[model samples]
Structure formats: C-alpha cells, structure tokens
Target: MAYKDSSKLLPPPSANDIISVANALNTLKDVKTTWIIGKISLTPGQQKFWFEACENCQKAINVDVGWVMRCPSCKEESRVVARTRVGIAVDDGTGSINTVIFGLDAEKLIPFTTLQFWEAHTR
Candidate 1:
C-alpha cells in the first residue's frame, strides 16, 4: 500500500481559522481545533480528578449507587480508572479559560495519576 501524506488532505488556512484561545472561544462551532498556548495551572483546592469508567466502553459508571455498576453504554459489570481527568486553567495572553483534559494529555501536566496522587497524599 502507498503511504499517502496526510498534510496534503488538509484544507488551506482560511480567514476564520482559530489561531488562539480568544478566537476559539468566540466561534459558534461546538468543536474546533487550535493551538492552546499558555501556562498550565491546576484548579486550586481540587480533590478528585478521576472517576471509575466502564472498561468495555470507556464511559463513567454510576458511582452514587456504589460498587457494582452495570454500565449503560457497554452493559458491562466491571470498570477501571481507565485514565486521568483534570481541570486546569490556561491563559494565552488574549484570554483565559478553564478546561478539562484527560488521559495522556492530562498526564503530561500532572506528576501522578488519580489513584497514585490520592494514595501518596493520604498516607
């Protein structure tokens, strides 16, 4: 199979292209991509950053009921930490915003995962 370059498939930059945080925030589209340039800061006094999710479908489980949960999305009975979820503030000169990042992206800013962080601090 021929290895096609993906850069060829992208459209040329348009005037409406999201160039910064302010531009992205002003756009009406529900989803868009842009370079998030800013200093990262954790939300102060924040405790929990992750929740149990269905291993099969990767969705949050019903935690209020406790222990065993039948995942509505996957209909599975088991769940796992799956990954991390974090709330952070980013300021890119033009503006600032609070956003949630998860998985490997979240891991980049944090020194530890949810369980590891809690365990170390609690002990």
Candidate 2:
C-alpha cells in the first residue's frame, strides 16, 4: 500500500487564530520601538540626504549616536536630525506585522527598508 502525501494539506488559520496573531503583532508595535543608528550624508546641492543605518531593539541595546556633521567654515559639529514623518503598522496578511515609514512629501527612506525593518522587529 502506498502512503498518501500530506505535506501540502495543512489547515488554514482560523478566524480566532488570525485575530490572536494580529493582536500579538499590534502589541509588539505598541510596546516596542526599534531605534536605528546611522549616519546621514547630506547633499545640499541636490537637497537630499543619504542615510546608512544599523537597527537595534530599543529594549535590548544602549543608545549611541553614530555620526555627526561638521561645518566647514565654523569648525563646529552638529548632530544630524531626523524626524518620524510617517509611521504605520499593519498586518502583512501573512500573520506578521509590517511597519512602514516615509520621509517628507512621501519620499522613500532607504535606511528603513522593508527587509531591514522586518528583520529588526522579528526574531
């Protein structure tokens, strides 16, 4: 007798299970905020800034500023400032949370790429 192949016959998630997972993901977003450290290189001529970042779990790591920009004329250094322009968290439909951020005028922020954010937030 031949055995049936059952590997592809897994049951779909139930509504209650889906809701539970959603609640858990929302809780993660509510309780955890990942702090990403990085340097921003400014191009004043082009009116743009490029950021290279390293993300850490805020609850697990120490805060450290990664880089500073110095004025060429005044010989003074200034901390690069970044504001959270937009933040949205939602379920990815795969039983996971997806958080997205955009810069001013909906410009894409490269440092917080989807993969990077997912990796940082998820185990």
Candidate 3:
C-alpha cells in the first residue's frame, strides 16, 4: 500500500465572498461567507434581553433574589449577566434568513443596554 498527500487537491473559496442565506444553509457547516446584515428581530414572547449567569463559570443563573442571580451548576451567586436570545434578519438580496447573533456583534447592532433593549422591545 502507498500513501499520497491530497490536502492541496482543491483550492478553497475566497475568504471574503458573500453568499446568500439560502445557499449558506444548504452548504457544509465549515463553509464560511460574509453575509449581509439586514434587520433585527426579537422573537415573540421573548421579553428579556439579558440572562443572568454565574460569575465564575458563566453558566445560566436560574435563581434570582433581588439583584443577584445564583447559578445552579456552580452553586455561586453573582450579578454577572449575558445576552439572552436575539435574531438578526440577514439577506443577500437573493433570500433572507434569521440568524442568531451574540456577544459583541449583537451589541453593535442593538446598541442598547440589556435593560434598555428589554424595556424598548417589550412595549
């Protein structure tokens, strides 16, 4: 038996190419593309913008008392918070899809504190 190197058999696509949402969904999970940003939508009945988490482990905080939320997993109480749930409506002109954006990207698009976003959206 003989071994051959086939790593460079095919050239990868350009890293900056933008692809349609529909196409991206159908392709391999590893395929990357620069999708266009469109609209921001919070799903119905989702009123909270941030979720409380354990300060040490960053796990979800299920118990809340006044200003503190305690983590069940770590058994620690901390006021640390994290973005809850959010969806960004993205389109490449060919089609549109609701993609979940988190962390810094979500903050950039929303541009509001968790409490503010919650209050604004809820009303």
Per-residue CA lDDT of model 1 for 1-123, tens digit only, reads 011221333345665653677876876276544546677788776667665666555566645312566778767785454446788988888888787776556767778876675455446
Q: Write the per-residue lDDT of candidate 3 for residues 58-120, one digit (tens) a residue.
A: 555554412565556666666655544466566656666666554444566666765566456
- Estimated TM-score per prediction? 0.66, 0.20, 0.51
Residue-level lDDT of model 2, residues 63-122, one tens digit each, is: 223445453433455443332223333433435443433333223544454334334534
Q: What's model 2's TM-score?
A: 0.20
Quote the lDDT for 83 in model 2: 25
How much RMSD separates candidate 1 from the native structure?
7.1
**Superposed model 3: Cα runs more than 4 Å off:** 1-17, 28-45, 65-84, 115-123
Question: How many clashes in candidate 1?
Answer: 0
Best by TM-score: 1
Cα TM-score of candidate 1: 0.66
Candidate ordering by lDDT (highest first): 1, 3, 2
Question: How many backbone clashes does every candidate have?
Answer: 0, 0, 0
Write down the worst ten-residue block by lDDT for model 2: 1-10
Candidate 1 off by > 4 Å: 1-18, 64-68, 118-123
User: What RMSD does model 3 have?
Assistant: 10.6
CA lDDT of each prediction against the hidden true structure: 0.62, 0.34, 0.53
